[model samples]
Target: MLATVARPSPESDPFSPPGIALEASALMGLRHLARRGTGATTRGRSGLPGGLVTRRRGRGTEPDDVRPWAEGDDVRHIDRNATARTGTLHVRTHHEERDRAVVLLADFRPSMLFGTRRALRSVAAAEALVLLGWRIAGDGGRVGLCVAGAEPLALPPRGAGRGMAALCQGLARGHAGALAAPLHDDPPLSPILEQARALLPAGGHLVLASALDSPGDDFSERLAALAERISVSLILVSDAFERIAPPGLYPYATPDGRRGTARISGRARPAPEDRLAACARLGLACLRLDTETGPEGFAPLMERLDAVL
Candidate 1:
């Protein structure tokens, strides 16, 4: 069943930025694409179909039985040996495997509430999760999510149903809450990653979306370990301001209403590319997305994900 939560009106929250508002139209477009099953185009190194293929034994590769050819059956599965021996058209069928689980880890911490281009990092992360959830559900797979903020929310993996809708709603709500009440304490991502790892089954898919600027020192090691068991994708969501702050003093206010001016330099501290390289060194498929683009920005990343999955 899908989870339920109280949704606040858009006008109720004055502090919340407009860009952070969830874009229903964009999400619907992605949902339509997912329902059409148009994103599964990658092949794995083992010669198996990539991006949410069944793992359990089924009518996949290994032949289980030879039966009389039926209309609408795939012609590629024709059993030449059986057909020639019986002097009749026959086709081999294998046991179909169960759907795989897809887990999305969204970092909706206070830091993600800031963005300069299109939407806040938190909103971008939520949008990305929505697209992935729809794609996975449309592909006959299950979707799960873990939203990390001051108060983390976890939804177990489930097939296309109320559970998926609940998960999407939970993300949207969580993003708004995070923006309204930014957390002062830094939330550790390692624990969330560990929890998600424990929840996912072997051969499942995992996607982690966050700035990943200061994931604990052992974050890379833990992520590498998890990738060994399942297909993992890391999305680095950022803002244009975070990438390059103009050379001037900019006034900033905290959640507590404390206002201050900070000086900006020609270069952004802790270059985002450095994190990208770090993820690369760990042999991870990482995609860098900024606020300027919408959820449609995920198309290219999904292509790269096809190769990794």
Candidate 2:
């Protein structure tokens, strides 16, 4: 039997940025949108083929990665970064998800801060993560989080516990930090994938949410390499202005108080299309999510999404 998903009301649009910043409550509320159509997307739709799942060791934590410390845990393997950030004792534990762990990577770079719809692209990314994370956790799977930007934050996979709570807190913190960060060249996604590689086990899933403004020249090569080890899903977060900008100069100011004017025209959009084409070539699962449609529209799209699992 198919399930019908509830629609979020505009008056209480959870994706809306509160006080020009994303509220943690809004992000957590996205979990309700995950109840239906999260698991078993498109029958016979395993992201990475069985033969392509590889075993490799990369820099960063291992699959038996970060988790909340318990009475019997060995304190020496504690993840200082995660522990310090979450203000909770965390220890590295070796474990694997029986049904494949999911690590979500969100791009919080300056580019994602721009939006012309319900909320900033970054906030939408956070919503997408929470929805998917809860769905995965609900299915008795572990979920992890990774933020890509000038400074990246990675949380090891956690089941339905404090670890999951920590992951949400991490997302809120990471987004807030990015919103206040100074303008600079956003880092490439390749390195972040390497970090993800280190986090997952032999067969895991990687979900990336980004605007694709600066994927770096080596993105394809790195993506192809990582695809060999993990099932990869790409969410191209965009805005209406990026696709077809209205003919006018729109004034804008970044979070850091930098003012600028954007000259919107009917020029063809290339970056996103190019990136999508590349992912398509690898037979990767790619989904385009526009900030204009907001979570209200995209959450249902996720139900029918065949490739992202």
Candidate 3:
């Protein structure tokens, strides 16, 4: 059984730093995006008797209704009895067989607290979560989340209701809390992945957003196992500086007033590209979001995400 964190009390601190926040306007924007058809139909191989659940209409066990056939209606779905009786083409439509679980694994470790150009990495992650959550909810699917920080938080999958609202609020609180809380040993991605696997129903979709800079040795094995069971995608959140550090001596100090100076040799970093390649090698779809560019820069990427989910 996975240990679950109790939902935190709503923060009353108006002074909370401008980090990741869940705003109504942003969520509304996502609603508009969904209306514009950003939410992709779900598709994946789950090895189950039935494949992935999708919104697309298809031949299902349960009979829905018979209606006049349209030009694009599948010929196989034509009701022979109705067609003969009415001397007009008629077709059978079925309700969606099932609702798919959409789980978001958001990383809120201390490393996500830093950003140079746009917003903190944590903020970007939160925005991405909100976008995905709303997109799935708008598509009439369930949404859930697993937040990894000092203390991990999990909300089981639910439809667009109070559950989704709680999830949005929880995401904002989790990211904000991470900034003010003391540092601790960050939880490993493997265990979180395990919990997510347990939470998601078969054929469900999982979206993981993180810097993914320090996934432990067991990460690959666990990811591969999870991928075999369900659809898995990765959103690699990174700062421009991480990919190409400026050439100069930089000084930094901790909150405790400990100061240090470091030299940046302008060496090119391959970690970002390497991470993308690794996802490809594992057969996991990956999206890279740079903090400097923000999410708006990835219109094509968002479309790809829609098609995959």
Candidate 4:
């Protein structure tokens, strides 16, 4: 069962940082940065289905080559200017765009509500969705969003301008819902992933953003199976406090006005390490983003995604 909590206070709290929230308008600032990559979507091409790292390029189309007419060639391809100049039949080749279907899977669970920096983990995930989600839409690729948590929601893929608008609005709606959602037990991600799969085609890509706080034991196995059909990318959202907290006793308050004390030390948690290791072993394109990370951090990641785009 899911309980409903009131909106978090704007004041500072030990577990919940002050002024940490999601704003759809603020995500547009990411647009200028990752201009190259188109979210998580696979280009139509040939490669190993088991998570192939491939950059799909137009087939024999670049440089507008003028080649001698071959047997069974289409008449529409004939280059009249070249044919007249060379006194022989020639064909003109043109470049074409590769199409991809992009979708983002966002995890907004109990753990995502905590942050010791600029914003909550859920907010960061929302930002990532806006960043790549818009890029995909701008590139003429269909964009879809699936929010996973106590109240899961799926927005089917839509193309171009309207698709981009829906994605942004959906982020705002989903983030607000996550804020009010109670701390239900961490749910298995398999069901949400299965739902996302149904929305995409064979070569589609699924971009997942999460803190990996409570991914089930079969998470890695499930990813391996999914790789056999579609491309996958991961965005690891985290906070500096999660890695090492300054030594001190911090006062915290819950949304229900309950108060408590949390002792903090500099020891790091092992969960992030294990999750990162699994991603590495699977050869997934993974990017780490902390609450303090700025747009400059996305340059390299954008380049890689751009190639895949």
Task: Count clashing pairs, candidate 2.
Answer: 1
- Candidate 2's C-alpha runs over 4 A off are 1-20, 37-99, 265-274, 305-308
Per-candidate Cα lDDT values, in order, are 0.68, 0.68, 0.68, 0.67
Total colliding residue pairs, candidate 4: 0
Error of 1 at 76 (Å): 23
User: How displaced is residue 73 in candidate 3, in Å?
Assistant: 19
Q: In candidate 2, what are the lDDT values of residues 83-134, reduced to their tens digit?
A: 9999999876543223467788988877777666666787777777777677
> In model 1, how large is the Cα lDDT of residue 29?
50
Q: Candidate 3, residues 1-309: lDDT per residue as tens digits? A: 011112233664322334344453454454444344442323232211122354445677557789999998889889999999999999998755654777888888766766666677777777776666665675567888888886688888887756567787677667656755654555578988888777888668888988885667789898988888888989888777777776898665433234567688865445877888988688788888887765565434555565666
lDDT of 4 by residue, 20-110 (tens): 5555556655666656443344333323221123444333444346789989877888899999999999987655333457678988877
Q: Rank candidates by TM-score, best first.
A: 1, 4, 3, 2
Model 1 accuracy (lDDT, Cα): 0.68
Kindly indicate the candidate among 1 and 4 with the higher lDDT. 1
lDDT of 1 by residue, 1-309 (tens): 000112344456434445666544445556754444344342223223325663344466555678899998898889999999999999988755434687899987766766667777777777777776775665556788888886688888887756567786777667666766634654668899978877787667888989875566788788888777777788888777776666998766565555667777677445678887877777767888776887566655554554454
